[model samples]
Structure formats: C-alpha cells, structure tokens
Target: MSTIARTPTDDATRADRTWTLDPDRALPADPAVRPIAREIYAETKALPLVSMHGHVPVEWFAEDRPFPNPADLIVVPDHYLVRMLVSQGVPNELLGVPAAPGSGVVAETDPRAIWRRFCAGWKHFRGTATRFWLETELVEIFGVTLRPAEDTADAIFDQVARAIADDAFRPRALLDRFDIEVLATTDPAWSTLEHHAALAADGYGDRVVPTFRPDPVVLLDSATWGQDVERLGEAAGEDVSSYRGYLAALRTQRLRFKAAGARATDHGHLATDTTPLTDAEAAGIYGAALAGTLGPGDADAFAGHMLFQMAAMSAEDGLVMQLHPGVLRDHDRGRHAVFGPDTGFDIPVVTEYTRALRPMLEAFGHHAGFRVVLFTVDEDAFSRELAPLAGVYPSVRLGAPWWFLDAPDAMRRFREAVTETAGFSNMSGFVDDTRAFCSIPARHDLARRVDAGYLARLVAEHRLDLDEALDTAVDLAYRLPLAAYATR
Candidate 1:
C-alpha cells in the first residue's frame, strides 16, 4: 500500500501570499496636487534616514553576523508578531517565546514550524501597520511579490533565509544599504554597553549609538529595582543607597553612556507628570524607594521629581531628553505574570500635558541647552496640548506619531492637527522607533509616502507652494530629527 503525504493546515495558509504595491496608490489624483506631491516625495525619499530611537540588537552591529532564520528575523524580535499571535489564542511557546520564570513550556525549536504558525495567522494583521510594513519589506527588500500565506510560507521563508545568508544582509551592511546615517538603541542604566564600545572601537561609531533608558533605576515598583540599583551603583562607583548618592550615580552612568557615543535619553513613564521637589522631599522618597516600601503616590512623586532632575541634567549636559508618556503598561496582569512585560499588553490612556508638564516646564522649559522631545499615543492632545506646548517652549519639540499612532491615517491626522498650531518647524520629524531592524526602510518609506500625500494636498489647497512643500517634506523625512537631537 502506498501512503500520500498530507500537508499541514498552516501550509495551506502560506500558499495564499498576494500583495498589492502601488507607489502611486495613495498619491493625490488632482493634477495640481499630484505634481506638488511628486516633487515633495522625490526630494525627501532620497535623503538619508535618521533613526534616533529604536531597539535593534547591538550584537547585530557588533558581531556583524548573518541572521539565523526568517522566523527569528521577523517573529522572535518583534512584539507586534508575538502579541498578535497571542491574541489569536496561539501560545507564545508555539511562537518560540522563552521559558517563563515559573511555567515550563517547550518553545518551538524548528523555524519552519514557527513560520507555518505565523503564516496561518497572517490574516489577523489585516488593516494594521504590521501588514503594510511586512508587505513593503517582502516587496522592497526580499523581492517577494506574493504575501506570506500558508502555501507560500516555506517558499517565502527560504527566499528570506537565502537573502539573510548573503554577506550583504549583515546588520552593518544593511545599515548602509538602508542609508541610515544614525541609529540609537535603547539600553538600561545598568548595562555595560560592551557591544556599543566594541562597535565604536571597530570604527562604526558614526552610525550606531546607545540611548540611556533609566526606567529600571527610576521605577521603584519594578521587580528587580533593588538589584538594578546596586548594578547602577557598581557601574558608577557611587553609593546609591542615599538620595544624593543615587543622583550622583545616575550622573556618572549618563556620562559613561555619553562617552560611549550616546546622543539622547529616553523616559517611559506612566504619565507626563513632572515636579520640582525640594531636596528633603526627594531624599525621603529616595529612602522609601531604596527600602522597597514606596507607596503609589510616592512613586509618582518621585518619578515626577526625577523628570525635572533629568531635564536639569540635560541642560547641564547635551543629551536630548525624550519623554514618552501615557501608556497603561502591563495592562494584563495575567499575561505579564506568564509572559513578562513588553509582550504587547500595553494600552493607551488619555494624557494631559498642560498640567502634567507644568512643574518641569516651570523649572527648565526655557533653557536653551535643554531639548525635550515629547511623544503621545493620545491623538486628541496633538492640536490641543502638545503642539501649543512645543510651539511656545524653546526647549520643547513634538516627536512624530509614535507606536500605535505611527500609521498612515494617524500620521495624516497628526500633520493636520499639529501643523496649523505648531507648524513644521516645531516638529522633530520622524523616528522609526522599532525593534524590527528589517522594517526600518519600510517604516520610513511609509512615512515618506504619507508625507508626500499630505504635501500634495496642501499644495492643491493652496496652503503651500511646490517649492515650500518639497523643502518641508525633506526636513520631515530627514534633517529635522537629526537637528533636533544632534546636541552631541
């Protein structure tokens, strides 16, 4: 008897790959607008991309090694993939999540299996930035015409795998290929940055740099706060047990990062609240944080005070301060317990910048040496609060649509709402803000397309001329971000 091989159900899904790429699909149809947008997009698309904030693994640049597989390249490193798969009831382990602290589940070892699962679940990403980005990447980078459905899964994987195996796909090579002039990776305060040091020592200092993210050190409620604080102290050679000493330790670490080619500092707080607390109050809160007995209000106050302190430090030093607030992070306690933080459980909340930023603005908002780039998930605040705040304050500039808002519709809305009040100059242009390195070009390409479309509309409406719109598009795509954060 002869047996026939039965293909997996996931394989069927992989065969459905089909993508529509119309470079002119989103372009304005009116003759007047089309010409203006064409001119604008042509000028901006050629500028060198500047990625001021991202999560690309430093090892990719330091080691300059080939990526292992398509699944590892697209699935494992991206929260967008993991979160979507989890939402569809696919277990993270099946998608290759590592073992949790307490639970035991065998992670998928075979990249093909992981690819099959991801391919089967690709439909869940319809109408998302993920869909747009992946489609663009498949077309532009890998030369894949069809989208990754069940039937096309293996073929697509094989194609990407072959491409990655090529010498040209190395991280450093891709950095140059993508025309990325500057890329910053977020690193914790306790990190040694041996990889960053190595990259610089290897003479790649002009491209990759680290951004100091002090969340683990400032958030006393973190599970590893005590140990992280100790690590910070050890790195700084200061006694972080005391409030004064802790601040000193942070300063030392900031200097260390600066010496390692850091150009910016990032803060991921629950809210945008900032305070100018007296020394006594700060010291008391610092004492509580060290003892691990800080209350909710105490933690908020301490974080707020630290925001102002960070701004003061920025004024003294040169690192640009990036404040990303209004995320109700770790919303799913169960998922957080099982999978861990940054597993796509964070949700946006209504944020008030006018009141929350008063204390810090009152202290250092006028300082010319300090530059604060504010980001928001709340679109309502763009015209109402953020644009106005950035428009008036010499130290403040609006970061482009971020995270959930970094899409075509959201980008259009942001430009419409904020440009009238804040104008193009008050904005710092676009930052990809992605962990997925391969998606960098796609993300930037999407932004350029959207910006061109918007500029075309402006010219059609007689709000801007072809020359002005073209210049603005180039600034929004390239020059503004570099200039805004180029304090170093």
Candidate 2:
C-alpha cells in the first residue's frame, strides 16, 4: 500500500465541516482493482431501478403527496435508524415513535427534536449500511451537504424541508426522478388493493404493483389469527368455516393479486420448513385454529404445510414465490408491547434450508411454471445450503443478501459464497426491501457498487473477462430481477 502522508489539519477539517460523498465511495479499495470496479459501476449506476420486492406503502404513489418533514419521513419510521439509537438506550418515544394502543407511552411530537436526536446519535451509525443509505439520501435526494451532527442538524433539516416543498419532490414525481421502472409494494392477502387499483386507473398499474404477503394468516398462532382468517375469507368472498374453504380463499386471493398486476408472493415465516401435512392432519389443525384450541406444534406444522401448498399454488398461478426466513421479529417483548412491530428488534437465529425445503423443492424443482427465490439472514446457509440447492433446482434462485446481511462486506461475502456454485444465472437481482421510499435508490446504489467491486475482483484475477463482467453487472443491476419476477 502506498503511504499518503496526512496532516492534523486534514483530520480537523474532516471532523467539523460539511462533506460531499465520494464518487467512488464503495468501489474496491485496491489501486489496481478500483479503476475496473469504477468502470463496471458507471455502466450500471444510471440504469432504471427494478424493485421487484419491497415494503413501500401503495398510498404514497396513489396519493402522490409531498412527504412530511425530514424526521417523520426519514428518522421516525426507519427501523434501521430507530434500532441503532434504541440500542444505545434512546427510548423509541424520544424519537417520535408512537407506542402501541394503550401502551401509555407518550411519544415526542416535535419533528425537529426527533431529528436532533438522530443527528446527535449519528456517530452510532458509523460503518453501518444504514449510514450509507441515510447519507446518500441527505446529500443526493435532499441536497444537504452539511454533516449530520448536533450543530448541523437544524441547518440540514431546513435544507431538506425546503427541498421537499418543491412540486418535484412528490412521490410520483420521485418515481420518475428515481428512474424506477417497476416498484412492488408488499400487501397483505386480505387487502382489497384499492390503492393499487387506484394507481392502475391513473396508468401506473404497470410501474407500481403489489406482492401478495400472507404471513398473518399462515402463521396460525397469532392472537388475531381468527380475525385475520375471517378478513381473508371476506376478501376472497369464500366461506372459510372449513379447511377446504380456507384453501380456496387463499387461492382466490392469490388470483386477485395477480389480476392487480402482482408478479410475486412474499413469505416471512420464522422457519423455512415446507413439509406437507396429510389431509386429515391439516384439516384437524385448521379446525383447532378456528376453535382457538390448537395443540402444541400445530402452528409450526400448519405454517410448513402452507408453504408447501403455496408452492403448489405458485406452480398453477405463476406468482414468483419469495421466502426470507429465520427472523425472530420483535425480539424484545417490552419494546414490542410499546412499539408494535418493525421498530426493529428482529434477530436472526440459525436457519436450516436443505431439509426444511426438500418437500417443496421435490414437487416444484423442475416445474416450468414454478420459481422460488430463497433469502436468509443466516450466512451459514449460503454456501452450505442455498448455493447447492439453487445450483441443481431449476425453480429455485438465490435472493440477494437481505435484512441484517445487506451490508457491503456481507453482500461481498454472499457473492463469494454462492457465485461459484449457482453462478450468476440462478441469482435474483437486487431488491431494495425498504419501507423508506427515498432510501430505495440509495440501497440499490450500494448493492450495485458492492457487486461492481465483487466482479472487479474476478476480472483482476483474470477469471472473468472485462466485457463479460460488464454484461453481468447490467444483468445483476437491471435485467435479472425483471426476469426472476416476471408475471408472464
């Protein structure tokens, strides 16, 4: 490594002044490798985003309203930002995060105060992917050059507020500004998709679509399971007083999702188990669930059996199946009670996939109509299970490193782990996977840079030609997700 002598003045200047993002922020650090990485990155950087899987609210696009103040828009709702501060003993209420109904916690209502809290705790986000995305949003989207700190917080906030006040900053405007070709919002199976249909009527049907999420109904042990099941039956216009009716309701709902331009079905169960239950066993479990007297292990067994059934439904209906498992959501019971869900106490445990998914794979692995993209927070499953499974199964494709593992190094590790076995063809392109709308471009940019660096290393080692690497970068950045989640 070349030694570049630094002075104390440089350190002082960097510490206190406004900063600009480096053009080559996340490129490979190697002197020889970086230039190649930059070239690959430049080619893919401006490509229209293909967000085939995400959690952005459909109303944002449907209403097309200007976003709220900076804090409400960026600070309060982002679980990534909220969790880091909470980890440092900052109460969620102190950041304007509302308590659950009857939790009796009065949240901070002042947007500027919440923003200041975020800025004051900014150092806690150092070296995290959240920091990268936040910084990018601040500088690129809102045009804030000032660093996020206590002294600069108000200045930065004012700049962002002024920027978002423009008509150009509205949700639908940003969809075009962000060059988002296809944005998929996660929707419950019971949803009427009124917002999606509204967007469709406004001619955004092809660009903004919904992905069917059936977690609340499938994970049968939830306290609201009965109500959620009833809602599902109502949505599908099916009588779900029996197990067969429940199945029909789900199938009907999936078809409705497809009719609304949905291309995929999303599952976030705690495990990847997909063992099919016998007809009698499944019916008995359904009856118990309906009666609110389910036996031990019934919920887990039913969830698994439902996953198997989901694959069969996918085979018939052609909704790309997306599964990201092994998250223990709302890990802190007290925090969950106060904050409901997605205030981020989700933790990942060991997730086994080979045996867990064997039953589903055996039935649909070679089916032409079936496609499943497997994602996990457990990196151990990457090389050991995911790569090998995707290598052989035509229906299975490896999802991008997601959730807790979506950082730069983690993404690089994912590429290293699976590329050798499954190769690029069996990998789904990047998915932003955020509820934070402005962070979409930032997240996708980070993924592209990390991928560019990974491919540059391959090129530097003479394993992949520069031309081939360039094409693969475009595939990962633009084309792959389109193909992987294609409705047709």
Candidate 3:
C-alpha cells in the first residue's frame, strides 16, 4: 500500500486552501499546553474506535463494493450534506435526492456536477464541526491538500475517484485502516438482517453487528405501525392483535436479534415519560393502538407503558436498553412533505425527565439485571435532572451528548457539567451517531482529542493525576462503551 503524498504549495496558496489537514495545523503551539495535550493525545490516539451506535448500512461490509464517486459516498446519504446544500439554495433533487410530488426539479446524476455544487457552497459549513471532520477525512484518508472549492472541485473529485478505485480504499479495507474493532448498525425491528447474516457467515462477525431498534412497534401512531406490528407477529410466531401476544412477539423478536449478534436495543421517542399502568388500562391502550384509534394522550400513555414493559423485558433478556429522547423529528411539515424524514429537519424540544420517568424508575431503577442508558437533546437537564438520576439509579446510565450536541463544544460542556455529579463511569462513553462512513475515524479522532484536552485541564488543576487521566482517556475512547453495550 503506497502512501499518497500532498503536492507542495506556496504559503499564499496554502492559506487559500480550506479543507486540508496539515500536521502542523493540529498542533497547539502554546509552550505549556502543547506538551500536556500531546502526551494525553499519544496515550489515547491509537486506541481502536468503539462504535456502539451508528447508522452505517451492513451491505457496505457484506458486498464490499468500491464506492462509485465522492458524491454518492458523501453527499446523497448524509443529512448534514443535504441540509447544508439546501441552506445555500441548492435544490435537494439536484444533489440526487428523490423527487417528491409538486416538485418538478430533477436530481443530478453526474458526480462532477454534484461535487461542483457542493464545493460552491463550502462556506456554509464554515466554523462547524462538519467542516472539521470533512477536512480531516480529505487530508488523512484521501490525501488531498487543496480545499474543496469551485476552483479545485474537479481536481479533488478526480483524485478521490481514482483513490476509491484502488483496492485498498474498499469499505472493508477502510474499516481495518480506521482501526475500528466493532461497529454496531441500528436496524428497525422489521428488518430482515440478511445483510448482517451474510457478513457474519462470510467471516466478518467479529467486526460488524446489529442493534435492535423497536420504535415502529412502540410508536404505534406512525403510518406503517400496523403493518410493522403484523410483520413482527409473523417474525415471532405470535398473534399481535392481543396485548399479551404483542409483548410476547416483541420479546421473541428481541431474542432473535440477540442470537443474530445484537447486544443493545435503541429507542427514539418524543420524550422519556414511562409508566407502569394496570393490566386493564395497558390492554385498553394496546387494543386502541392496534385498532388505529389511539388519540394523542392515549399515544403518549401507550409509549410510556411500553417503556416500562421494555425495561422489564430487558431485565429478563439482558439486552441493554438505550433511550434517546427529546427530538421533534421532521418539525417542518413542508420539508417532510417534500424530502421525507431524516432530511435534517429534526429539532430539539425541552424534555422533562424528573417527573416523566419517576413511575418507571420507582419500579425498576434498582433492578440489578436491567440497564437503561438515557440520552437527551435538552442540555439544561444534563446536570440538574439526568446526572442526579444516573447518580442514584442502579440501572440508569447517561448516554453521551448526541445529534445536535455531538460537536466539540457540546462534548466539552457535557464533561464539565456531568462529571462533578455522575462522574465518567456513569456515562456510556462516545458513539458517532452518523450515516457518513468516511467520517467515522475523523469523528472518533476529534472526540479523543477533545477528551484529552479536557483531561489535561483536570491534570493541570491537580484534580486528577496524569496516570489516572490516561486510564480514563482509554476507557472513554475504547472500553466504557463496549462494556456498557456488550451483552451481559
């Protein structure tokens, strides 16, 4: 494997370049801070990345196909890329987004056109973490020095296209090059898992696995909930029309996922409200939901009830339950009407966990077998509500700052706010919840660097020794998440 070299450029030319990662650029030249950060970075830099939760497709590993172009690999599938392009007045269809009704715009199929448009809007990502990650990927992975602008778009595109055609740049090869030991992709309960099975049978079981996400069954108000429930029933060999049969069917599907290498179950809901309703009330709600007559309040109650039921099921089945709540998905109805879900239209809403989770926690918070990891988009609740909850409840652990809060400043603020109360162990470490595959290593590298910088502050303040901080860095980078999500 030959290393790709960057073409030497003059200082003026380098200054104009926007998306390259120079070795010197990452260095902190401050005499005092540079050495301390360097030492901390060295200790954790080479640690294998642990991707407990992400949105990568299993077919990428199963088929091992060479990516066709930079646009297909980075633009079409990424909500970040699409959102940024939209903000710059670039039509989504022009970037290959599927056209919706009433929008007569056509998508651009040529890779060069998409790349040109995307580069022209590069300024939209200025000062954002997306820019940071993209630059790191271009430099470290693609070996490009010129920034992605209109002038250099064709050059960078041709270079990346050639590099991708190389055998070393294949998906599996990139996974090994990224030093990712294990990566778990989130799959809905109705998914067939055939791709995962093929990958496992083909001898990649140790590296890629599936995570069970049963949101369709829990969120009964969704358009396809009835169909999903019926499919789940078929998969589990249970009649899901009845409330008890539904729970049984869910358990069966979860167990099947566990056998297929699922170690955790992910829940994405509007809020974290949980309830342990009486059997009669639970049955009534379930029947209404099954009949497609559930009201707004009834839907909330059913979701809360399912949370408790899922916890109880986890107690028995040993799949770690992860609750990521407070996202108002597709808040812009117009965007949804056109682009559909996950088009970067989701927004964070204020969430209340104290009273919302009281009933459920009072029931299973102390249970030894049950483990619930709570993640919130509401930053205000980090120290006040979430930290205290995780600090007390034996089954509760805090998930890392996610989605809109996964940036460098957000991560730094999270450590500062929660470390004093919940400490590091009560947190579930880091997970890059992204759909972009090339950005995985870059995201992990940024997290490790920010964590090391935070630890350096602690060491400088004499609150933690250098040795202990080094161990904490390693755990935060590699061990804690793997242990937290690993099947007990």
Candidate 4:
C-alpha cells in the first residue's frame, strides 16, 4: 500500500483523502499466509489477459473511437453499479437505464448529474468487488488519486475525460495497453460478423475472435423468433421453415462462425436440460413452433433437443461448448418495463444440474474430441453437481464463479467446493465477462489475488508444495482459459 496523499483540491471532503489501493488488497487477511500469497501473486501480476469468454462490444474495437464521457464509460451501463444504486432506492432513470418497448420513459440525460449520483453512492459499494474494479480503474488507469465522492465527482470525471480524449486511451490502444492476448466476443449465430470481419481484414483476427451465441435463433418462445429464423435462413442460405433445414442452417452458421475465427459456442438458457428427441418428434415440434401451434412444454423440449444436437455438432467440429444456464433475467417486471433487459434486475434461483443434463452427458461425455464448460448462477451445484460431473466426464470442465457470485468470498468458496472433487485441471480459468472495458484488468487482478491466496493456504497446509502451488496459480490465472478455448 502506498502512503501517497490525495492531491490538494478545493473540495474539502476529499482534501485529506488517504485512500489507496493496496497491491495485496484481496490477499489472505491472515498474517501467517500473506507472505506466501504475495509471492504467488507477484509471479503472475503482469501476465497478459485471456478473455476467452466476455461480453465487450466488438464495435468498440472496429470503430476505434474515443470513449464519450466518464459517466457512460463507468457509471450508467454497468449492471453491477446500477443494481446496487437501485437497491438503495435510486430510480433507474437517474442512472440512464433505457425503457422497454411498451413503457414510455426517458432517463437522466445529464452526464455530470449521473456521475454525481454514482459518486454519492460510492459508500454503498463498500466491501463489494464493483468498488475494487471502479477504484482500480480510477487510480491505476486514469491516474486519478482523488477518491470518488460528491465533492470530488466532477474533478474525477474531468480527470477521466482528459484521459478519454487522449489518443493513447482509445479502445484498441487500451486493448494493447492492457496487454490482452486473445479477447473473444459473444456474437449472435445469425450475425454477419461484419465488425469481426473488419477487424480481421485490419489484421487483428488472431487477437480478437468471436464466440457463437445461438440462443436468439433457437429460443422459440420470444416474439422475434420468426424474424430470428428468417435471419438464420438468410445467413445459411437454407430453408429454416422446417426442422431439418433449421438444423442444417445452424450447422452452416457454426461453420461460418468457425471460419471467422470462432473457437467456441456459447449458450445462455434457462435450464441445463439437454435431453434429445427422436427425429420425428423433433421435426413435429419444430413445425408446430414455426406454425405457432406448439404445446406449452414443446418449445423447451425442442430447445433441450437442440442442445443435444449442438453437443453432437461440437463433437464433430471440435469447438468447445459453454453453457451458462439458470438465470432469471429481468426479475422485477415493473423495473424491467422501464429498464428493458440487462439493467441489473437478473436474479438466480435454485438450480439442479445432475438430473437436468443427464441426457446430453450420457451421449457425449465420453466423446474424445468434444469439450464442454459449464457455468452456473446456482452455487449449490458447485460442490454437489458441477465438480462431481466435471471430475468424471472428460468432456466437462467447471467454469469460474460467475455473476453475483464473482466476489472474493464466493471465489474462495468456489475453489474449496470444486478443487477437492474435480481438482484444478478440470477447472476453466478466470473470465472477466463485462461490457465495461476498463474493468477487465481489475477483475482479472482480483481473480489472481483470490486464487493466489487459495493456493497459498494449500501450500501452508502441506497439501501442495510451493512449486506446485505456483504452477497452479499461473494455470488458474492464465493457461487454463487459453487451452479451454484454443482453436481446433
């Protein structure tokens, strides 16, 4: 920790601020293990980032424009920040959340006012990982030493704005500045990948790749399902009006995605069910869904069947499959009406994976060339189901603690739950799944510190030697994710 004092400012509230982000902030709190944890953290602190799975927009890189302002850059769009503020009774419109289709609403338009609101709410984020990421970006990336508070909000915003306007702080420049190795973006299956193709033609294909997200095209209950099918058909040049043609279109889309530097297929479904249906059964359901006459359970059944077929396709094509299921998006309908989706209203319910994924696992869990990485919002599944499943199935690996669980305590609990059963090798490494670009380094830095502390405890307990723990720390921070999404 540095003893550097805050720069002298006219704002009396922050004039004497001694807030500093300690290098070992998230390490083991126990003095006995701190040294070893520090040692392990030092070895990998400067390693390049591997964003094997993330939600950052590809247009940021393709257009390569300067970030608009501090509020949009940090405050308004991040769900974590928005959610915490809303929990404290702040209106969504105050933070600029966009309204849904039927609700007529206009959010706060003043950037400085939004920044003040966020800064005023900084204390609410105390002891949260969001605070860590925000503070790190302010101090480390923007070189702003002033603390975030009402008095210092404008000063800090101005400091960030100066950095934003600089040629050195542009999107592509920061990707290089942050030393990201390979950043994979989530894209729709029917996407033209125009931004990706542009980036590739600009000669950054190996650095920035796409992950095929087929949920929009396959999830039939949505009002836009017909349009999604039409888009898929257009992309694949196949008649997706029928089940056979739909499968062929999906296969063709996956091939296009792979050709454009994709190495993984991503699924964000409501459940982990991967049960397959007989060909006639699947065809009948698909026809009904298209004809708008499907039974209540038929859409879900067809989705599960599609997942089974997707596993089969992965087995054939060698692209890793990622399943992040069981999230209740837009939990509050009233809030959702005004905020649309992804405005920090998602909640996790109890999830069962063992029985849910049996059909798909039974079929392809033993496949030699296939691989699956599973993520959950349900932490109970970590020890009881996830680790045990990944332990036995050659195809399955446990993804990092994600969503609401991606915090210091949850990360420690994750290692404790999964390592004893599946061991470290069956784990996928850290992924900073954020649309907030600057938080990537902060999130990864936190993950490394947490993992280093976990490994240090193992070393101190004599469960692992110093060398092995160090190796495991590096693997968890860097190597494992690369191998998990490595090109076929």
Best by lDDT: 2
Worst 10 residues of 1 by lDDT: 1-10
- In the range 173-256, model 4's lDDT, one tens digit per residue, is 998899999899999888889999999999889889999999887788866788988998998899987888999999998998
Candidate 1 residue-wise lDDT, 1-488, digit = tens? 01113345434334443455776644566776776777778887778889998989888899989999998888887887788888999987788776566665567889999998998887899778888888777778988755667777888889889999999998899998899999999999977889998998989886899999999888777788889999999988999889999999999989988889899999999888886789998899889877767866887788888888898898888899999999998888866777777863789999989999997887788887889999999999999999999989988999989989998889999999998889899888899899999999888988998899998898888888878988888889988998898873
Q: Which residue runs of candidate 1 sit more than 4 Å off their true CA positions?
A: 1-20, 29-32
List runs of model 4 lying over 4 Å from the truth: 1-12, 16-18, 100-102
- Go through the candidates in order and give each one's C-alpha lDDT: 0.85, 0.91, 0.83, 0.88
List where candidate 2 sits over 4 angstroms from the true fold.
Answer: 1-16
**Cα shift from native, residue 338, model 3 (Å):** 2.4
Clashes in model 3: which pairs? none
* Clashes per candidate, residues 3 or more apart or on different chains: 12, 0, 0, 0
Considering summed lDDT, which 10 consecutive residues are worst modelled in model 3? 1-10
Best-to-worst TM-score order: 2, 4, 1, 3
Instruction: Order the candidate numbers by lDDT, best to worst.
Output: 2, 4, 1, 3
Model with the higher lDDT, candidate 1 or 2: 2
Clashes of 4: 0
Cα displacement (angstroms), candidate 2, residue 57, comes to 0.7
Judged by lDDT against the true structure, how good is candidate 3? Answer: 0.83
Assess every candidate by TM-score. Answer: 0.94, 0.97, 0.93, 0.96
lDDT of 2 by residue, 443-473 (tens): 9999999999999999999999999999999
